[model samples]
Structures are given as C-alpha cells and as structure tokens.
Target: MSRRPGRVRRAASAALLSLLLVAGCDTGGAEDAGGGQPAASGAAEVPGEIVLASGRDVTGRGGIRQQLITEWNRQQEAKGVAYRARLVELPGSADQQRSQLLGALQSGSAEYDVVNLDVTWVPEFAAAGLVQPLPDRLVDEDVIKSVAETARWGGKLYAAPFNSDVGLLFYRRDYLTSAGVTRPDLGKDAGWPVVQQLIGVLDAARNRLPAAYAKGWTSQLDASYEGLTVNGVEAFASAADGFSLTDKEGRYAGSVAELQAGLDELRNRTQAAYTLPDAVHSDEADTLTDFAAGRTAFLRHWPYAYRTLHQSLSAEQLGVAPLPGKAVLGGQNLAVARGSQRTAAALQLVAFLTGKESERCLLDAGFAATRVSAYEDGALTCTTAKPAGQAAASPTGERTDRMPRDGNGRPAYARGTLLPALENAVQRPRTPLYGAFSQTFAGQLARLQGGTPPSDAQLAADLDRQLKRALPSH
Candidate 1:
C-alpha cells in the first residue's frame, strides 16, 4: 500500500502493533548486527518460536497480512501448539525493504523464519540461493501449480501467494447510461481503441455528471518502480504474447513504439495528469486517492481500492469493469525462508494462512482472496450500501441510493468478470534485475511523455546498458 506524504498519519495503535509483532520475534530486539555470519547450517525440527519478517506496516488499518498473522497465532495457541509469532515490519517501499533484506541475509544476521517477498523478487532471491524450495507434502498440487507458475525460476517453486491483486477498470455507470450509451459490447478482449471511444463519449457528456467527478481517466503514471512495472511493462506484455522483460533466456520483449503510443494515449486521449508532476515517480496509492476523491471518471487499480472507493462514492456512481486497454497482473506470494529453523512449523503456517478459514478471515477484513472457494463464501458476498437518508445523493442515482450492482446488475461487484480478467492478465518481466529495468523504463517513459519520440534502437541500447549494470557477472 502507498500513501501520499503528509496526507494521512499512521494510526498510533496500528504502528505500535507493527513494532511489537516484529520486536516480539527478534532474538533480542537488537537494532542492528553489523556483518554477522550467515545462519548456522542445520535442518532441525520446528523451533519453539517463529519469526515472520514483512515489508508492510501491520499497524495500518485494513492490513490483511497483519490480521492473518494475528489470527494464526490465536488459532495455533488455542490448539496447544507451542508456536509463537514475531513480526518485523520494514519500510513500505519495495526497494527499501529489498535492500534491507539482502543486507540481513548476506550478513547472516536476519532471523526471520518466514519472509514475505514481493512476487517479482522470487527470481533474484532464488538465484542468490537466499530462499528455500517449498516442501512437497505441505502444499497440494493445485496450490503449487498456481503459485509456482508465477514465482518459479529454473522450474523450482520459491514462494507461495500470500495476497493477490490486479488492475480493473472503474467507470461511472450513471455517466455511461445518461450519455445514452448502453454498455457497449467491447467484449472480453477489449483493447485501447474501444476504451478511447468510450472515454470520448464520456468527455463529451462531462457536463451531465457531478462537477466533482473528473472528465477523463486516471492511472499510474508516476516515475516510480510501480509505474513502470504496472503501466509500462504490463501493457507491453498484454499486447503481445510470450513477452517477458526478464527470463532465463535473457531476451527483452518490450517494444518502444508500443510503449510510446500507450503513454501518449494516457496523456492526450484521457487528459489525465500524473498525481504529481513526476507521476512516473509516484506510487499506486496516488492514483487510488485521486479516483476515491471523485477527481477521475475512470481509473485502473487493484481490488484493494474497492472498499475505499465505495466509502467515498455511491454504488450508482461507481462502475467496476475490466480495464479498457491492456493491463498487467499483480499479486503477492508466500515463501519459506532458506534460513528458517522451523521448516515444519513454517510450512504449517503457510498452509493455515492460505486455507479456507484464513481466506474467509482475509475477505472479511476487506481484502480479495486468492482461493476460488473463498469467492463463493456467503460472508464474502455481502456489502453495505450507502445510507438512504444521507443528505447528498449520487449524481447517478443508480449508484448512490441502493447497493451498486455489478456489470450484470447483480447486488455486488461482478466477481465473475473481475476474477477472469485478473487470472488471464499479463505480468511484468520476471527478471532478477526487474527493479533496475523498471527504473530505466520509467525514465524513458517520462521523456516520451515530455514530447520526445522514442525509438526501438534507443530503448534497446538503454536496456543493454541497464542489464550490464544490474547483472555485471551475467
């Protein structure tokens, strides 16, 4: 989760909880261990205590990971198991956490039993031999098949999915209807031209909607790693098949022409500005906040933004659809640490966290579940609509007064349509050097948006330079 600087303060209680969870697990709350040796070598039985190191702030409200850990601890303790959980919350940025984790692991000072890694880091972590392969007995074939495909390197499973997320198109139902445009049958394989046509229709009728709503579109355009990973690389991958930014074969499949065209459309066609002047430098939270505040008519964001947007706008006014253009797939995964002393316990923890009961808990806490079974649970199907007696009504009464209907006019968001879009969605390049590549890509995209035309030769040269810098020995 991303947050704007000074937009909101971290909740005190949640922050405290985050710290306590981490400190409780640390061997001695020792702040730093400078250049310590790697962990001792031994595959022993489960230890009495287990530590879970995470990159997210668990103290924040709506942190599903924090809630999952807390629930796991409670359930395990009740069953008379002697297991204890300690959480270590790192800074929120993926780069910062990655640097810290690499330092800790290389120095053999990191004491985490199970490490929560971003999906893209699997290849790098596995290549360095910093994480262990999952045991076969603990996870079923289907679960293994789903996660391993996303987190694999050289045909080995390095991580299991912890939480999953993806980009979906959020539109204004009332706006579309008032424009006299019944849902255009863009069909399942809708592309950029179709989306542009719809945006044009909305822009023409902007006067019909509330003044608060924006006349155009909004998405991640910041120059940060997320901007490149989500908007640039993902878009390129979706437009073409077998396109990977990084693979063992070491071939980069992105095209500068396609990337430039897409970025131009984002700027000129939608008239959408970056959250900040250097939006290519911003994070996903910026886009989410803009959409939630009614500043944009259409947005591409993960489902986690659903509750927040629902709280900000009425159902009649809010519309959730698959992204009009190509979108990238995004989600988190779970993995056992190579340095873990409690393999059995760690595997157990993974099983419990990804199980049916835990998925229900996560869904109830306002997070999307990865398990197919959780989607059908009755508890996950319910949503509270805006109170009818509220003084203000949604400009599209279809959205404001009653529970917003899904694309099919059902009582809830369309899960049937949403999940398939995410499952079949494209992903960023799976490279050990994805972080560096994203940085370089974001810079190029920024220049392109500034009216510089991009050429494949220029991008190929830049990528070559980045590859050398990121992987000198390779």
Candidate 2:
C-alpha cells in the first residue's frame, strides 16, 4: 500500500449528496466540526417543541412527511401534549448538514430533538454519542429489510430509516426501440457484468438510436469526487455488504485488483464512447439532467431523479431497470439527539416518522420508502425481469406495492426498476473517517480515469496505501 497527502477533501454534500454521491456525490457545501465536546443524553421527558433537523425540507405540499408532522402537531395542540414537533431546515448539501449537526452536537447543544441523518453518518454519530441508540420497537423488520439494516452498527439500532434510495439505470425506451434493442435486465444479473453487457449493447446500437440522444450512456463518473467512489463500489465492491469494502469484522474483503479491474473496464467503456465525454466532469444532477433533456439513451442515478425528471419525460419514454451494479444506498434516518431535553417526545416523533403510515406518505412524495410495506402497499415495485437471456417480466401478479405517481396520477418512473435497485443498494465503508477514505479513493479513481491511468498494479497499490491511511488497521 503506497502514495499522497493527508489533507482531507471535505465538501458539503447531503441530500444534494442524493441532490446525490446526495450516484449523487459532488462537492460538499458546509464546514466540518471534528473536535466538538461529547454531549450526554437527557433520559428524562421534557415536553415542548421538538425540533427535527434534516438536510432537505421534504415537508410541505407533496411532502408526505409534512402531512404527517402537520397531523401530529394538530393532535399535540389539541391534547396539549408537552412536546410538539416541528422541522428545522438545514443546508441542501448532505455534507453541510452533517457539519452543522456535528457542530451543534459536539458543542453539547440541545437545539435539536430528532436528527434526520444520512445513512452513511450513523456510525460517526453513534460513536461520538451525538445520537442515542433506538429501542428495538423503533426499527423493526417491517422497514425494508436492507434499508433498516443501515440503522444498525455493532448490532445496535442507532437510527430509523426515514426514506431510502438506491442507484438505477435510467434508459430511454423510445431510443432503445428505435435502435431495435431490447433493454437489459440490470437487477437479475449482478452489477458490473450487467453494466459491461449494457455498455456493449448501447455502443453497438448508438449509431442506430436517434440523433437527439447524443450519448449512448451516461453516469456520474467525474473523478476527484465521491461520485466516482460510489461508481467504483457499485461495480466491483457490492458483492457482500456493499461498499463496506470490508468483512463484518472490519477487514478488507475487496482487493485492489478487483477495484482496478473495474476501473479499467470503465475506462475502456468510456473511451469507446459509450459513456458521455463530459462524464469525467459530471455529477448525478448533470447526468440526470442530460438524460432528461434526451441527450443520452441511458443514465445511472439515484431514484431521487424520478420526481425531478417527471415533468420532462413520460413514463413510457423512461425505462427503469436495476443498475448493472448495486447502488450505494442513500437516504435519511431518524435519531434522537443525545443532548435534547425532549427525549421521550423526540422518540415518539422518530417512531411516527419511521412508522407505517409515514412510510407510505414519504414514498408517494417521490422519496424511496424505507419500509417494505411502503413499497408493497404503496405499489413502488414490480417483479424484476429474469436474468439476461431469460424471459422478460412485468410488475404483474397480485402484489400490493404502492405505485409512485405524480400529482397528475401518471406513474413517476416505473416499478421493478427502483424497487429492485433499492433492494440491491450497497452501503459505503462504515468508518467514521468516510470523508478521508472517500477523498483518497476519489483521487486515485480520478487518476485512473485520466488519459494515462497508472498500470493496474500501480493503481491498486496506491489505493491500498491510501485506504490503509484512512481506515484503521485490522
């Protein structure tokens, strides 16, 4: 393991970080507070205004969360409940939100009651005691099994899934049809191999697709950022526990060779013109926006893009499928602030936010649900297609997953696509030093994506060295 500096490349990413790496990582928007004093939790019940802080304000009209909070507030007001809940909006950048929350929590401030955290930050917050672990009653199996799993670390439930996300391949059905190409089933097959085949097919058919579709495929491949790290994990490292990049006991389970191989494959694919030329500079929004503008036949992004693109594309034109690789999981989770005086009330709000009805409402608002029932009752998924060379299928059967629809009642994107994608989301490395690892990994990946990427062995060796720096020794 060998190469580079210790300066951490921090940025204010957050729900923009699903806004991608907020698939949706870009530069972060806020500052970091790493040296805040540890705060103690208030076990007693002090009721009053409980503040729920999140990176994004998914409240208000069309915000399923807002509706639930409104109802809760009404009940509280009517009953004169000691504590009533309200929302405290934060910066849109996921990373910035993290910085602010860290600053407050480390400073021993009780400014917040319920903390809506990014799934990736659970470990850091939990270790710092910035948030308290949840009772088993809060995070149950009823939440989407995989999503709920993100809330736990060392077998403790530190957060509750509020809304969850996974990456998917968004392709144009019309373009594929024009090319006489049958869309590939990305889910049924594993991530990287499926992507390889998809790229090959798209490359071969690029000439046949419409001129409006300027690119064969597009993704958040910009180097020097978290987006590339996500792509790398999605490709070669999603096998066991996603981007954890290590085994349950916290040892490197993925090899530099494996990651390098995938990077080389991507380099070849992009060089072959299957990926957009601008991809090296693109992030999630750039990729989605280009695809939505009909510039590309396919895109890889978080499901968060569906609502943003709904106005531009029809359901029929947009085809959703599993990503060739599993998606890096994105979304927010609920935790009670450690220093809050309204512990009991905050816990209640956390339950309500992560509860069944709330899940359904969130799903309908275009946020991916963290509960299986939300997808089932809300109709968010369809059975995926059989693997490549197998029979194509539809979201048929007597299933009851709720369909994601727009205000106009049109399907937001499609089923099977997002649902399967969410199920296959890979978690990132769960260390508190995620920013350091991400920064290092991103730099090496950027170097590889360059015209003269280092030899595989050299690149792999460099990666190993950097990760050893960012990660604790086994």
**What TM-score fits each model?**
0.75, 0.78
State the local distance difference test value for candidate 2. Answer: 0.63
Candidate 1: tens digits of C-alpha lDDT, residues 1-474: 243353332243233323222101101111111111122335556547678787763213325465556656665665566776666787757788888887877677977778878777787788788888875443454342333366677777777666666677776666667666787334666666666677678768777766765545666666645665477655555544555555564345444454444444444433333122323433556555555555565677776555456645676677777775555666666777777777667777776666655544443333455665545544332111111122223345432213343432232553565556656666666777777767776666665555565554565455556545654333
Cα error, residue 221 of model 1, in Å, equals 1.2
| Model 1 CA lDDT for position 397 | 42
The best candidate by TM-score is 2
The per-model lDDT (C-alpha) reads 0.56, 0.63
Candidate 2 matches the true fold with a TM-score of 0.78
Q: After superposition, how far is residue 76 of candidate 2 from its true place, in Å?
A: 1.4
TM-score of 1: 0.75
The lowest-lDDT stretch of 10 consecutive residues in candidate 1 is 23-32
lDDT of 2 by residue, 64-162 (tens): 455556566655555556556788778645667788899989996648878888887888888888898778888777777778778887778889888
Candidate 1: residue 140 lDDT (0-100): 50
Off by over 4 Å in 1: 1-42, 57-62, 137-141, 144-147, 178-180, 184-189, 248-281, 376-411, 451-474
- For candidate 1, the C-alpha RMSD (Å) to the true structure equals 9.1
